[model samples]
Target: MTQRKRMMRVPAFPNNAKLFALAVVLALFLAPAPARADVTKTNVGGTDLQANVQLVEYETSCRTTESDSDLIQGIIMPRNPASVRSVYFYFPGNTSEDAAVHEGGSDPERVCNPNTDGKTQFCKIVNNNQQFAVVTFNRNDAHTNTDNWLDEASDIQCFLREARTKIQAYNMNPSELFVSGHSGGGKQVAWAVANGGVGFSKTIFWDACYGTQCSSTAPRDNAGQMYLYYRAGTDTQADAEKAKQENSLKTKLVETTLRHPAIPNGCFLDPSNNDLCGGRGEEKGELVVGTVEPPFPLGLVFDETQLIIQQPQPRITIPGLQFSDPEELRQLIVREPDGSVYIQIPFLGQYLAAVYQWAVAAAGIIAVLVLIFSGVQWMMPGNVITNILTKAGGERQEESQNKAKKRIAGALIGLVLAVGSYVILYSINPDLVEFKSLRIPYIIPKPLVETDEPVDSIPFSALPAGAPDPALLPTAADVCFPLTRDSLDPRRGISWNWGSHRDGSDSDACEADSDRCHAGIDIYSKFPGQVVAVADGIVKDIRHVSRCADGWGAEGAERPGDGIVIYHRSLGLTFNYAEVDEGTSRVQEGQEVRKGDILGVASYCGMLHFEVYQGEVDRFQTLNWCPPGGIDVTERHQCATQNYPRPDALANPNDVVRRLEGNFCR
Candidate 1:
């Protein structure tokens, strides 16, 4: 806490000759007001509780200008200053030119101040009725104005601590706290509640709902509550959308404020309507906010006729301000019950166990009482004198019969009482009753029908007349044509010379005058087919077309579209294929694919961008076939045409296709 010097009051001289006296009076009025604290203690007229109204004036360290003091003047009414269970601090909406500390901000006629008029709506609805205290503070030295109270949040926390310390002197439950505000003040209340780190019990917003963090904040604990009430007619489409998103954080419903049947006061328009409230219950024990958007001035009220309706838990709408008449705002706050009170009942086994225990205990007590009564009857026999003259044998016989009858009756009565007690205990808590030796049966399921059979291989006899010989390839049995038979026909389709080409460039390596290197052959077909896997391999990587759509290369470089990399572990080689139609990459990353399996359908980019790499090739950086030294076009073409070792070239994708019969032309 920052220390402040107190200015002492000096006596004024009336004599004109005393020039020093006039100077002192002028300085007091012109200079900044001294920091001070004052308290007014009064007794509530009809109640035992006492009200201690306090005024604390302090200068905040935050300042942007040389003339800015950033002084905060606050008025606090922890209604019963001492022993408060909770506190509600309200931040007002409007602004004023001069400081509110020196000049009272509220108009005597418009704003309610219980100190001046005890009959004010604020006093009736809040201070006088609720057990918690209420405090109203300004953002700075000036009148309440901007909703940017978040700027002074740290300073406000310091002030709150001092207030808590003062109230702690008289209150036992000083930890319980709450925050509220209307309009701009409400935004401040939200920032304080969400980011302030204080464990507030509840927060009430009246005709104010706007906060950057409002969409993410939630109640701190099970007992914490948040209520957002605003006029619907005054809300814009954007405001409604923002409100919906914020309320969704706590899974609440936002609806137009309507007059509910349960509220004693129907609609605000009706003359007889007094109070309105309503809320729907929730099952998860989470925060439930019932929003009603009524037009401004003639605002909405909640009609809370019943607390909880049916199944799940009850939706309880805590009391909120009626905006139709701002002066008619009512105070309604309902503290949530602790979560431990709701317990689920146990099933069959538990119920039977409780019953057995209860029965045993009841039977034991009843048997003991019966034995005591029998002993008393045996010791004190009636008609002592007349029995003594009669036969001793008849007395023993009569005693024995009575004893037997008492034993039977006591046993029967004990059984009945024990049975009745068990029944009652089971009804209350079925889980407590336990059944011995109970078994639950399990049902066995039947087998499922087999699905589609796997296609492992395609016969070479299906290839066209000019297809390359498969026997010359190293992995002849494993290789399969990449495209379907119909799309790879030799006569109608055109397969240009095998080479490399920088994508989207007009210079093709296959052309004589071109300077570019075209790494793969361009296969043009009017009717395309699904591109199958070259051999049995596992999918290594898959880059979808969405990546290229986001501009992968230089400014105007064409997108090679969706592509896949397959790793043939046995052959120690990798196959790269791209420019497949969207959603046609049948093989996913890490998927195992067999020969002749559909890898994807080649369609976009005019042709497929296919490449092959040897076991030691660096697929990512392998590009030019020519070395750094001077090399003619003939040598570069020779290196690209055949699969050979070089500084730039690793393997030719076209040569692999010819060697493995993947190419239609021999």
Candidate 2:
């Protein structure tokens, strides 16, 4: 159907005009932010990577030490970034410097051979620094295969921490970000997942990942709540190798992850567009959008509004063709880990221009289809048998002249009707949307190839389980939390999930509408503090509580009055008794009281709201945490849907409780 015109008022993009002004400012400050030559930074060759016109590079501080052999060489592609969220450390393919080192690996210069080429193109390809270093170690040919797996897992943690420090997004920020890599990079990343690590929100390892403890590998332990992806070729020669490594890594990572403190989302990608990646023998490129002078947008909304305006790079823009250094380039990859922010700019090349050449070819195909169909209908037009004569116009005459006249008149009428119908339909309907739902295939008049029919399939149980599905997901107990066998105390193991709950006006400065602030810290009465007369005043209110998950906000809100509350006239303090399975408050409401007395069981639903009030007012108001736009505190909670199993269903519930009580991090 023809598209109806939508009368939407074009929004005023005030940000656009302002952004254009900034682009002008950027063009002026296109040089590296450094004076003469400084010793702290590396002498990364000469190119002002952020210049407005072309690819330029500048020197970076590559002065850190690695492996204790020589000073570490770091080069950066600096930019006046809008806001630096991440940094990338790229280890280009095995360095030629590696080849020069002997079995002794005794290169004091940290210089051996250069990369095979001077103009080296780089990509992260691997998920994290851990896997990258592990792969690098194997390249040394000195370490045993056993070290690879463990190195993969732990290195990931190290890499994540180090990358964060270098990025300097915030000096004291403790946000865990992303890791991305390729091939051997893919293999390294897979190993990281298989072996697991302490931190890192998520990782993307493509074309690589190995089986557990291959000759002494970590059986894929300690992984975070990661999203695992595997894409392999079906008919290609390398299919076996790709599938083997993928399955191995998948098996190990999945098994260990499901039972671990955190379970990651594992996805074996569909093979439909199996060749999406630059797999062996596959097409190397495809058509994509190109920008001549792309802007680094800040608060430049991409969805809905397609307005393009030049915006100056807040941190630094790589300019037309180059980055300030390698660090800048690596930092742009998305999935630096899950929850972290990243962006990728398309590479400039002649090959890229070729992808858009199809604009003309497509037009030619439509022209040919239309011409052939029109020619067939021009002759013989309507069927001779379709005409029916009206009494007012004519009658059947056996004469040859009458027959000829009838055919001609009928043809004219039929042609007129068909043409009229096409025009009227065209006016009502126009361009169609890419709605796959309504599309149906037209029947082809070509021969059909025959194939043999197969027998009915057997039951799913008849087939062997190739790889296990992720463990039944944790219920709602908040699995992303890092707890261990030593932390939880059953007497008061489960507490209300604070990260999920929020109130307004915390004594601590916080947004009034956040859900991040904890209402109060909950803990079991492990030491049993003495309870006495709450105060000289009468009790204000008394109520028992239960699981907030199931029976909250109802008359059952205070059942059988398991707990009690106490009011102190002199101190203005109200102490709540909570989670007692059953018991009337021991003291009378108006009775005089003293120091120590038994309160109630420390329970989740059954809990206390203890506050110090002055007269009728509480000074503190609890509020949720509201991070600035685009930055997500919720990002870290990968297993938001994850829940703890029923206490009795846990394999080691008691041990888990200890871990939960004590487990401080993920």
Indicate the TM-score of model 1.
0.30
Across residues 1-666, which tens digit of lDDT does each residue of candidate 1 receive?
Answer: 121111011112112212332333244235466655443433333332224332333333433222154344333444445545556666555445642332223222112233322112233333443444555555442424433354554445544554454454445354446666554555566556544434465555444555532333332232134444444454322343454333322222223253111111111111111122233211121232222111111011112212221122214322221112212111111111111111112223344454455446456545544544443333333435324523555555345436634664565456456555657878998645434322322121222322122212222343212222344344556576666543443332324333323332232222333333444444432223347777778887777532233221112444445667777766666767655655556668779988777676564444455666555232322233332232233432343444322323234454466555543210
* Model 1, C-alpha of 106: deviation from truth (Å): 6.8
- What's every prediction's RMSD, in angstroms? 29.2, 30.2
lDDT of each: 0.41, 0.28
How badly does each model clash, as a count of residue pairs? 41, 69
Model 2 per-residue lDDT at 82:
26
Q: Could you tell me the C-alpha RMSD of candidate 2 in Å?
A: 30.2
lDDT of 2 by residue, 227-312 (tens): 22333331111432333232222111211111110111111121112332223223222111011111112112222122322222
